[model samples]
Target: MVIFLAETAQVLAQTPQSLKPAPDAEAGAQAYADNCARCHGPTGAGDGRDSKRMHPRPRKLSEGVFKFRTTASGTPPTDEDLYETISNGLPGSRMPDFQRLPEDVRWQLVYHVKSLSAAFQDKPEPLAFGKDPGKGANLAKGKELYTQLGCNACHGPQGRGNGPSAATLVDQWGDHIDAANLTQGWSYRSGSSPRDVLVRLMTGLDGTPMPSYAEAVKPEEVWDLAYYVHSIQAEPRWSSKVAAVREELGWDKAPRTDLRLSSTFYRNGEIVPSSVRAVSVQAMYNEKEILFRLTWHDRSESRETPSDAAAVVLLEDPNSRWRSGSLRGWTGKTEPAELLSYEDGEWTALLKRPLPSGKRAGLGVMVWDGGNAEQGRHRSNSNWMELILK
Candidate 1:
C-alpha cells in the first residue's frame, strides 16, 4: 500500500507558509482517481488503459523523472512546480490544462503525484541559484570549462548536439534522448532563462545521461559557463521606430520570398498540414537593427486566444545539416527574432532584432495556424536562408 505520510510532509515543508492548509492526501487520492488514473494508471506505472495508444506515451510517475522543472534535473521538483504543471499541463502533449480546478484541489494533486514515487521519500534540499557573475561572466573561461568538463563529448564544439557520443544516448527507459542543442533556448524543456540553464547544469537531469556539475565546478565558474552559453545565442536585429529611418534603409522595397511549409513529423510518424502552405518574407536592416516583414494568408486571425502565431529563427551555424529539414528539434537551440503581428484574413508580422557585427547570418522561419489545432510541435517551417548583412 502506498502511504502519503512522507510525501505530504515533504509538500508542507516546501510550500510557503502563506499558501497553506497543508494539502490533504485523502482528498488528493480522490482527485487523482477522478482525473489522472485514466492516463497515469492506478499505481502510477504509466500503464493506464490509454497510455499505450498515446504517442511519446504518458510519463511513468513511479520513476519520478520530470522533463519540465525549475529545480535541479535529478532532484524532485518543488510543490510549486508540480502545481504549475498540473494547472498548465504539458504543452504539445496530451496533458490537458487543469486551471479550472480549485487551487487547493490542484495542490492536493501535487501531493498525490509525489506519493506515486518513493523517490520523494527523501527529497533533496533545493539548490541556491546565486546571481550571475556580472562582469565575471567570462566567455573565454566558460569556453575553456566547456572543454575541460567534457561537455564537447556530447554537446559538440559549436553546441550543436553533434558530438561523437551524441548518437548513442538514451534515457532511463531506454528511449533515445538527444544531447541538447545548446543554441536554442526557446525549446528548452525547462525554460531557457539564464537561471534555468544554471539550475540544469548544477542539478543534471536525474534519469538521463546529463549529469549535475555541482561537484565539478565552483559556483562562480558555473555562472561563467552559463554566460558563455548566453554569448553564442543568435543576436537579433533591432530597428528604430522612425518611419524615415525605415524608408532610408529600403525597407519598403525589400526582397520577398513565398516559401512552402509543411508539417513537422509527429512522434507516431504522422505528417499533418501546417494549415498554412506558404509564407512571404521581406527583410531589411538599418545601422542599428534588422527587420523582417512576414505575410501569410490564413482565414481566421488568432491573436486574442492562444492560437495562430509565427516565429523567425536564426541559426548559429550556417552549415548545419538541418538547414532544409524539419524544424521539430531545431527550434530549441536557435535564436528567435522578436515578432509583432497583425491579421485580417492574411497575417502580417514585423520581426526585429539587433544587428551583430557579422557579414552573414543563418535564418529559418515557421508559422502556426491555430485553426487546424496547430501548436507546439505541430507547425510549418523553412530551411536555413543566409541573410547577408550590409
Candidate 2:
C-alpha cells in the first residue's frame, strides 16, 4: 500500500529541502495570543504588559520584523519557512513551543507574526534554514513528498482545494470552506507578501485549529509544500478555519448499518445546547445503505456534559475515496436535523441491516475544538477509529 512505501523508503530516500516559506497570518495571530503574548506585546509592538519584567526586553515586533527571522534573502519566509521557527524557537529568544497545542497552530502564528509589518515586501529571499532549497529543481520530488507526508488527505490533489474529504467540515463559524486555496497570491488572513506567510506558519494561530508542523514534516518538505501550493494558486474557496472533515472520519469497518451522506460539519462544542453533542449524528450505515440504529459514548477522562440532544457517527468512505461509499441519516429527518446531542451523551446506532460481505475497515473521528464563540467554545478530544473488513 502507499502508506508502507511512504513510511520506509520515501521518508529517508527523499533528500530534505531547506525550509519552504509559506505563512498564514490568521493562524499566526491565534498562536501569538495563545502563547507569545505572555512576553512580547499582543500586536508584537513590544508593549505587552508582561514584557516590563524581561531583562533585555522583548524585541520591538512592529519596529522591524525581520532582523530576528531566518528568511530567503531580500524576500520574507514562506509558510513552511516559518513553521521551523515556531516548532523550534530561536535559541537566544524567549519564545518557546507550546507544541502541546496542535501542530498547525504554531505554523499559523508564524504567519501572524510575519503580518506584523509590510517589511516583507522589499525583503530578499531568506537564507535556507540549514541548506538552500533547490530552485524549481524539486517540484516533482516535493509533490511526491507531499502525498508521502499525508498532506494529500487534507490539502487535496494539485492543492486545488478539492481534497477527497473537504466538503463536510463545519467550524465555530458554522460556515464551510475548502482548505486554504494555495494558488491565490493574496493572503486570506494577512501578509501582503510571501515572507509574511512563512512567519505565520512558523507561529500558530491562537484560539483556532491550525497547528505548527515542525515536528512531523521536514523543513525541505515544507518548502516543497509551499512550492506546490503556489503551483495551484487561484481564487481561494477555504480560508483560515472553515474545513470539511467528511473524508477523515468517514470510514466503515463492517457494513452492518446504512448511511445517507456525510459532510464535514462543525459546531460550538460548549454552546451545544446542554444535552446536544457539538457535532452529532442521527444514524449509522449498513453495507452502503442507510440505517437508523446508531449510538455514541464518551469513553474518555475528559470532562463533558451528558448528550441527549444528538450524537455523531462515522459514515465509511462517504466520499468514495475508498472502494465503497456510505449512507447517512439525521434525527429531525429534515434538511436541518438537530445533529448535536442535547443531554444524553451516549447513543448506539442499532443497524437495521447486518453485515453483507463481513469486511472491516478503518475509521476517523472528530479531532478539533470550536474555540471561543458566542455563548460557546470549542473543546479538545482524541476520538479514535473502529475497524471493519469483508
Candidate 3:
C-alpha cells in the first residue's frame, strides 16, 4: 500500500504561487483595520484596547520581529510566511485563523503587515529545506539528541515546557516567554509535521530563547529528532467523549468518559486561559431520568453560593441556550438541574435531568471558578457533545 506524507507537508510544498491573490497593500490595510485592529492595533503596535487582558499579549507587528519563520533568524519572513501565519494563526495564542476571509483579502493583509516595519524592505527569501529523510525516525537516537542538545533544560524531560529554566526565559524585548509545550502539537504555531518541526529545528524562533540547531546537528539526525517530537504530540478526542447511556446493571458504576475543557473568554473573542484544563464525565440513564457526573481540578475552592458553580446545559434545547442567564439566574420557567461539591482543590458536580423522548441529545458543560473571579460570562466550557441513549 502506498502512503502519503502528512497533509501539513503537502500544504507547505503544494501551495502553488499562481493561485495566490495579488498583493495589494492598500486593500490589506483595510482588511487589517476590519479584522485585526482589536488586538494588533491600527498601526500594528500591539497596543489595542484589549491587549492588557491578553496573556503572552499580541505581537508588536511594527517591530517586525516574528517568532515563526522559515528564514534565518534576524530577518523578515517571506510573503508566503506572513500569508501562512494569517491563514493558520498561532493555535495556542489569541491570534485566530482568518481562513474565513477571502483569499485576496488575506493576501492583502500580508503585504500590509510587512509594510508596518522597515525590515521587509530587504525582501529576503526564505531558506531552502531538503526533503525529510528520516520518515519513521529513530526514536532512540532522537531521545539522545534531545538530551545532548540540552532541550530538557527548558522544555523539561517530558517535553512539557516545565524545565527548571522555563520560568526564567524571555524574548528579545524582555517580555516573558513560555517554552513551547511540545506534547500539544495541535497548539504549535507552525504546522506539526516532521517537515514542519524540522524547519523549526533548523530555523530557531526569532526574538525568543529557542535557538536554531542548524549549526550543531547533522541534517539526518535533526530529522530523527523532529520525528520524535512529532510522536509526542497529542490532541483532544471529541468522539471518545460521547456518553453512551446503557441500561446495564450497576448504573452508578458506569465508566466515566473523559474530555478536556479549555478556558472561557470575553465576548470580544479574548480567551482567559484559565488553569482548569480537563474534566471526567460519567453518564447513566434509566427509563425516567439521566444523570451526569463531572469531575475536574481547580486549585482553589470557592463555596460562594451559585458563584463557584458548575452547570450542564442542553445546548440543542431552545430553552437552555448558552446565552441564557447563570445557573441560578435562569430567567425561564425551567429550574436549574445541578448539584456541586468541592474538596481539596477539586470539584465533583452531579447534574441530573429527565430523559428526553429523543434517542440522542446534545450535552454541554460550564464551570465557574469563583475564586478566580469566574462568574457570569467568565467561565470554562466544553462544546456540545452527543449523548447516545440506548
Q: What is the C-alpha lDDT of each candidate?
A: 0.64, 0.39, 0.69
TM-score of 1: 0.57
lDDT at residue 235 of model 3 (Cα atoms) = 50
lDDT per residue for candidate 2 within 313-375, as digits (tens), equals 333433332532332321222111323231222334332323223233233323222221222
Ranking by TM-score: 3, 1, 2
Worst ten in a row by lDDT for model 2:
1-10
TM-scores of all candidate predictions against the true structure:
0.57, 0.27, 0.70
lDDT of 3 by residue, 231-350 (tens): 877554434345646657454667666565667676456656654555677788888777777776554455654346666665334345455454432212112345366553456777
Off by over 4 Å in 3: 1-23, 123-125, 134-136, 240-260, 265-270, 275-325, 328-379, 384-390
**Candidate 3 Cα deviation (angstroms), residue 314:** 11
- List runs of model 1 lying over 4 Å from the truth: 1-14, 33-35, 49-56, 67-75, 87-100, 235-390
lDDT of 3: 0.69
lDDT of prediction 1: 0.64
Clashing pairs in 3: none
**Candidate 1 lDDT over residue span 55-161, tens digit each:** 34578998888765556556778877687678766433456668778988998898999999987776755777676777767779999999999988887776755
Compared to the true structure, candidate 3 yields what TM-score? 0.70
